[model samples]
Target: MAITEIPKGFKTLLPDEANKREKILTSMERVIKLWGYNPLFPPTVEFLSTFKAVDEKFEEIAFKVVDRETGKLMAVRPDFTPQVARIVASSFKDEAPPFRFYYKGKVFRDVEGERETYQIGFELIGVNEPEADAEIVSVVVNILENLGLKSFQIDIGNSEFIDGVIEELQIPSPTTFIKLLSSKDISGIELFMEEHHISGERREKILTLLDLYGREETLDKAAQIFQNEQSLSAVKRLKEILEILKSYGFESKVIFDLSERKGMKYHTGITYEVFHPLLGCSLASGGRYDQLLKKFGRDLPATGIAVNVDSLQLLLERKGIFKEEKKDFYIIDLKKERKLAYEIAKALREKGFSVARDIIKRSIEESVKTAFGKGYRYVIVLNRELKTPHHIYLSSEKHFPLDDKNLIESILTAVKEEK
Candidate 1:
């Protein structure tokens, strides 16, 4: 088959795209590191049982293979949380409590088209306090703010909150409630209530409460409607988290969603999805999964978030957030005064300037046009004439310089001043 027909849903990232993605990833890593979270990198493949130990349903979406030597089943990781759990259990078993770690890498999943995706995130283990939860949320908010994402909402929810309410209803079939909640199907929940001899008043009230999703007011309404003590306590905890976010001055971006419950089964506490208006879906998502570490024989509490770098790039493009301006530089002559040209380019490069040499034997006009086409603002003409020295010409303005050093410095100064 031809190279063009290699496959679908797999494409290369050009220089510009790659640069933007790198900026976002670097920003996220810097933010997480600032919050005292150290970095860790696990292998891309692990024993299939590692994932299955947490959720058997992952077997279908995971890409499985057989170890040629041991004949053991292995699979590409679909998520980072499970692998981090296994690592903590094996290596850090005797370590101190509250081990915070971060990671950034590619994860594989058999979704609609693409089987591989880039996931940049972190995992905090061994800390279960409310302070730890607040710290995680603060880190997420800071990272988003630093990315220049102005208008986004962090919708926070608690699994125990919704699950406790369903249990308190004493419904004959809890599985139906789980399905209804998972699907966000209010009508299905109503039908289940009607079939189970639940009161119409209670069913309608609960359905209306599920739809009331936004801000701290949602928690107030939830507290009023939920009769279960555990569920009400969950609401209180969410409110406390909101208050902590406010103390960090992130109240404007926080939103409380009581019905938001779409994560892995291990997430037992606060869960959230960060949504921006430009991107229809979430750009980042994560929550507190205190019980996940226990499965690896290391019982501890942890909460963290993962930013979808590619999704973030998409959002930035849609919002016109990141616009890269090309650097201005001069291409020195290769024929006469080659040493002088090299010296000129070296001097400019040391000052954090971009300089290119015309070694391709192209004409001056061709080189100028090439520079302009590549987004360079100015082009420098170099020759061995000191009496009437070389000069820099801007694409926008037509100006000639009398001296070589003055011309080069003028171009560099111009670019710096523009910025």
Candidate 2:
């Protein structure tokens, strides 16, 4: 027989990693709920046409399969926002304005590496005001902080500015130009500009946009260089959103950049990405996609962010942000008094304690030694006498006889006293 092996770009998280991931997700879900966002779950698979319009760029990355029943191309979810849009537009088309939803799930991308990924995200639909944008950004800040990320920054950009620039400039092959700018391929852009006879201030303005990233002053610089209405409007929206975020006391985590033009084809207005020193890539990214729902038959404005849960978990594990609760008590009871020991263990657990009971009977000495070896803080011995069980504090090796009538209370009190 041959050996069985796991496939590449997939991983099974063992206890330690899984535990941390759960804690991070719990904290994020709580923070998201606190901000009045309701939970949402889009299907894991949808027809290929559902994402074909807005997510053409992701077609190569999406894992596609043929549905034998329908004979249509179906794909595992590559992103949640588009699926969310489809549901909101068709399922809740006439529901009303301003729906707030949060989601946590795994998304699959069929690239050569890391086919499966996890994301925690939220969306604010049918709202176009700057406040909606700020709220989404605030939620991201709150979630990262709640997850114990001490140092991180969000770089904000406006898709409108670049789109307006391309339209106003009538640039040929705009997508390729944007890709080159995203990669910061200066030589390629310079050569392209020269080959196209684009020289002097026109070329300078386009090239200078690459360096427009920093504090509030960056917006001023962008406004100065791109005097067109659309570019200036983008700058104006960015400034307004910044002011709103400043009022929320998140100014220190804000950075303005106008050169971020990737992963924003569907984003109509505000776009942002979050970074941390611990990771080479972005820890989270999101933005306003006002035009996304239009493809689904609704014209609701929307903005949201998706945190790379896997990346955040790695950072937290590296920094030791979460620790497993220590096992507190181990119960060893005589055969005849096993029921009483179980009752006591149940009571302790109901009161929010981690209690473990031995499945097999052993001598008091053997049980105590085993509990200590397994790092249990205390051991309780219940014999047939059922009068008082000896409580042994493993670290101090001190013994106390606990009254049976008040066993639960006495054990709890003893543990507290030890602390």
Per-candidate TM vs. native? Answer: 0.91, 0.92
Candidate 1's displacement at residue 127, Å, is 1.4
Put down candidate 2 lDDT per residue, 1-419, tens digits, no spaces: 33665777988987667867788888999999998999988889988888787868678889899999999999899889889898899889879988999998998988887789899999999998999989988998998888778789998888889888887666778878888888889998988787778777778778888898899999999888888899999999999999999899998999988885845568777887999887888988889898899999998899998988888888887777776545788887766647787788899889977889887666676778888877678888766353554554555468787866788888878878877
Give the deviation of candidate 1 from the true structure as CA RMSD. 2.6
lDDT of 1 by residue, 333-352 (tens): 73664877777788888887
lDDT of 2 at 179: 86
Q: Note the Cα lDDT for every prediction shown.
A: 0.78, 0.84
Model 2, CA-based lDDT: 0.84
Give the top-scoring candidate (TM-score): 2
On lDDT, the candidate that comes out on top is: 2
TM-score of 1: 0.91
